[model samples]
Target: MVKIYYYKEDDSPMTAPHDSGEPVAAEELEKLGVFYKYIDSQASVDNLATERQYKNRDYITLDGATFPGGEEALNAKLDVFFNEHIHEDEEIRYIIDGTGYFDVRDNNDRWVRTLVEKYDLLILPAGIYHRFTLTDDKFVKALRLFKDEPKWVALNRIDGNTESNEFRKEYFASLSS
Candidate 1:
């Protein structure tokens, strides 16, 4: 099941949740411009592809399918992914297997963590500060999507790049409209 909650501010493991978990509703997520969908796990890959094509995610790359260097390599990738950052374009992912948490900064600047599992499709609007980390299972297979050629650039918040970013401005403007 998909779970959305306010992330606890602490030094706990990324996958650990707070006692309350402060659940968030789907409508709240929509207001933040986060799109989420759940398809039956039994659905064929072709069906998922077709649905994605309809949404303009034409480029797809699978990660965690064949980890040559094993879990350590996957951990390295996740370490990079866990950094809070914004992308010039939207970040899209279709969870092919396993579970993970995506922490997105809301309008109030609070962290909203969402749990995504098999068959979950999540799209973070361009310029939204977000990060991802796998659950204790330490395994996840995801199909990253892009509209054109894949560009996996993360403008990290630590770089102070978000304030002047065009996409970031547009995203905030969209919330007001």
Candidate 2:
């Protein structure tokens, strides 16, 4: 029952823009199969506490759960460590609380800034260079699901320096300004 929305090779999902809001409903989530889930932001904190019960709950490699690491991991203050450039095999995210923006460079070289808030699910395919920054509010908590067993790849760390690569330069330049 997974719903896969494929963009044309010329139109990348990255760089697409969207408004922030509540998580997608359970029925919609079920259709995504193991793709993603946008945890409801309006849910009481007590209800949100049971997020872990859904861990490893699906057969797909991209199983996701909101607030996976708990409130401490999510509520921590935002820092540069949180500002990162990543390109993954497949990136899936579910917003559990707060709001943020994801800047992505699509295959067509178009830049899209997508505003995400509670309950918004975002999925990005491989080879897209992207980064995230805190919203003006500076508070965000979400579940990140990766198709790869070990989900994140720091391009700066892998490539050694952001300046050495053209893609890195473009990525940083786009996000910074």
Candidate 3:
């Protein structure tokens, strides 16, 4: 099941209703500008490649998989992304196993913490200030999506980023026009 939590950008939990109840359809998430999909969890470890194989001719894709190194390793990577950073390209993942949270910003700049589990495919728009973390179990295996070979660099918000300067937000927003 997928869960989405609304929070403060600083990572503080929201006082109001954060968990928006049970997982809903990806189309529902689309309304909130999130791209999500549910697939076969028991599929092959390298499934995302096969999955992307059938994309329309005009749809170009380049991606790879990630196996979360349990708690310690996840925490190490967390120190990078969790600094509340933004990527130049969309951050996407297809969960092969385990669970984790992708904390993104709502239009109002508050955080929306989305919980992704096995079979869940999550796409966080580029330039969106967000963070990532695993659940208590400290386990996760996922297929990462990319437009091309990724730079693997996240421009942290702490380094002089402002709410109004999200280029990827406008980039995708324009596509919807």
Write one digit per residue (lDDT tens) for candidate 2, span 1-177. 112222223442322323332233434323222233344553632243344332221112111223445534443423333344555344566666666665554434433455667777666544345556555555566665433354445564335564565654554454435
lDDT of 3 by residue, 10-78 (tens): 444321234544444445457556687677753642465456442211221111133345545645665
Number of the top candidate by TM-score?
1
Lowest-lDDT window of 10 residues in candidate 1?
Answer: 54-63
Extract clashing residue pairs from model 3.
none
For TM-score, candidate 1 versus 3, the one ahead is 1
For residues 1-177, what per-residue lDDT tens digits would candidate 1 score against the true structure? 679998888887665664255899978889999998897663554575566563344433224546667767877877898999999987878887788889989899998889888888888999899999878767677777776667788999999878899999999999999
Q: Is candidate 2 or candidate 3 better by lDDT?
A: 3
Model 3, poorest ten-residue lDDT window? 55-64
Question: What lDDT is obtained when candidate 3 is compared to the true structure?
Answer: 0.61
lDDT of 1: 0.80
Sort by TM-score, best first: 1, 3, 2
- C-alpha root-mean-square deviation, candidate 1: 3.3
Which order, best to worst by lDDT?
Answer: 1, 3, 2
